[model samples]
Target: MKHGVTVALLVVAAMAGTMASARAQGGRIEERALPYTPLPADIQALDEVIKAPLTDDFVAKSFTAPDGRIVPYRLLTPATATVQLAQARLPLVIVLHGSGSIGQNNVSQMTAFAKAWALPALRQRFPAYVVAPQVDVRSADYAPGGDGLLASHPGASLPAILALVDDLLGRLPVDPARVYVVGFSMGASAALDALVAQPGRFAAAVAFSAVPPDRDRAVAVAGTPTMQVHGDQDTENPFDPDHAWAEAVAAAGGAPIFVRYQGMEHRVPPDMILAPGWREWLFAQRLKSAAPFPNP
Candidate 1:
């Protein structure tokens, strides 16, 4: 009888130890292996799933402009996007990538900002529409504007982008008043283009590592809520001119929220995007405003 009691106690202690080990390794998820029962069909399915790109996260797609230009893009639909759309139209978040993410393949820009939006926790917290488009143009395509501004006929893709938006709205659901656009580097210039070219279209915009457009276009989108983020020590794009441009926009009644990352270079910082109030602040901007505020 004592031997039996000792054996039962040992079994219970072993399970307790196993439970404690799991609790201790909660944050170190990488040490865990893929659990499998080793059934034939299960093993084959796992192999196939592991080999394929994460389709549930984002999918490669293309759009053709009215002028016959083929613009390749990647679309990311949050798992709850459809459900959220049903209850209330979700906002559209357009993400544009920098020069390094430029390519004809349409996959570079997808990965640049896709991970941030596709994060499981972020997706659950804020489900919305996200579009990342890839452009093939390079340095030569950009035309120099007066003092610290680069210009491009970004209107070229406006048609295709609108078409995609319309298609999404028809099939899914969208909050027309909450449309927002965000971009980085070269993409920032494009965001300015969209803002200027299509005023009253976007509720708010976020630009990173970008200078303003020409002096004339800078004030064209006045009253539009905008957030401009730049690095003060940016060697490639420089900072003095963009800082002045942001000041000029503020003076022109745009009143853009400017965030210059001190001592940082020309790159997007994780803290700026993932910080606590960032998501709420970005989604809370509205187009109708009598008194606009600008932060320096």
Candidate 2:
């Protein structure tokens, strides 16, 4: 068998046992089960390149929401020389971290997935502002329905997170039409919450292992471009509900790209981050209208 496939099979085999154990102990399966079989060497290298020490260009900042909540976040801007020469407003990408990285340290939220946007080559090619916001607790809420669908709502922290985005848009030369949001696990749920809470605000969104937004709100985000990436074998956030959510979106007249990884668990797929397709797709999107903020 090919090495990658072999490794994937091993991962799936291990997860089956791990999930069984967790269920037996009545424990919640979270990110503590990470470091899933080391990824391919090329992917490993790419991951390292992005998550390496933040260069001097990455700045740490905080935002105070209207509700008086303080949101700590790290912002990455393109090289000063690049920003100055750009004639058009730049895109803004909000990177939300999963629950495992939740904290007030202002640094834990800079997960490898969040840092992918700061890659030197990607930054030079895309040339956008990237912000990774950190919260001290769960940043979103998820309720499972008896009908087997999962409903997602913005947690107390998400309003502040979006507020921070607004604050950045006001002061920075951000192209509202190109605003995008990406997140994983818990953050993934928050990304959908952002979409549901304010429908016309984001240009596009990319969510990984996200619990689908409530079926009722599916129509709200139908117009926005969204891509959901999930593992078929995910136990933390079951795969079936996310799949159902995509179907709901399609039924609501939306075309959402749902990428399924077979035999994988609740972990970020290396391909999603290492490949260039996501970046290409992300940069190609713009809001239908050029409104600078969410429609009130």
Candidate 3:
């Protein structure tokens, strides 16, 4: 009986030690809910969601490029983080704002959706760094692609944005293996540009209502995991092209998950944004060299 009790206690101690090690490594999560949802009425609730005020925790700052262009941004440190955990590294989430939110004030870019990351629930559940960069103009340059659709390339501001990310990684406990970018409308297009611009830098990308870049650039981002969410009824940046982009990326051996809202218009669906699954999918991604990426 004494021998058995000693063995059991040893096992329990080993288990506890393993759990502590996991916590020290930043508690990486791999669970994700369903990725696709088609809701017709979700669009109606966006106004309320958009008007939601941003929390005060996101500290405002500005990044100035070598060329002197300034990009205003808001940064949110993990609510649970502190100076004590010297070896801890956490994921970094970059949020891009739509055209309507563009400005140098640093606060206009704090859309209701962008503010969601600072929510107590989200901060507690997925504590990490969140940065929202505001540019004076579109983050990517757009010109007619000669096929009646616009072709996009990285704009001048993008380099600064990327530099800002590097700055954060240098100064913060950000996990380079789990960097992510997300945006809506024009910002969505910029997010894709950023992903392609720095391929292999981002673990994953989630674009909402984005304009597709030129077909030739599809292969550049073929290895990165991506999710494109858009409403079928979108008129601002036609949905068909974005859909085609997804297909093209898939054809180029890229992994892309396209979420379509059947009867919605040119707007981000509030229901999906506020869903736990969205964060679950975003947080589940980590840098991987293999294909057939995990389905979130």
Which candidate wins on lDDT? 2
Give lDDT: candidate 1, residue 207: 79
Model 2's TM-score against the true structure: 0.83
- Model 2 Cα lDDT, one tens digit per residue, 124-158: 87898999889977878888654557777788899
Candidate 3 residue spans exceeding 4 A from truth = 1-53, 81-87, 146-148, 289-296
Which model scores highest in TM-score? 2
lDDT of 2 at 251: 68
Clashing pairs in model 3? Answer: none
Give residue 295's lDDT in candidate 3 (0 to 100).
21
Q: What TM-score goes with each of the models?
A: 0.71, 0.83, 0.78
Give the lDDT of residue 151 in candidate 2. Answer: 71
lDDT of each: 0.59, 0.74, 0.70
Ranking by lDDT: 2, 3, 1
Tally clashing residue pairs in candidate 3: 0
The sequence of per-residue lDDT tens digits that candidate 1 reaches over residues 1-296 is 10122221233224323423432333211111111122344334334434445444777787776767677877777675446456756777888777787677877665424556765556677677788877765411255666545544463555566565555545545577777888887777677777877777788877777755665666677566666677777887666655665666656655555565667787765443333234555676655632121221
C-alpha root-mean-square deviation, each candidate: 16.0, 9.9, 11.8
Residue runs of model 1 more than 4 Å from their true location after superposition: 1-56, 81-86, 138-144, 147-159, 166-171, 289-296
The positional error of residue 139 in candidate 1, measured at the CA in angstroms, is 10
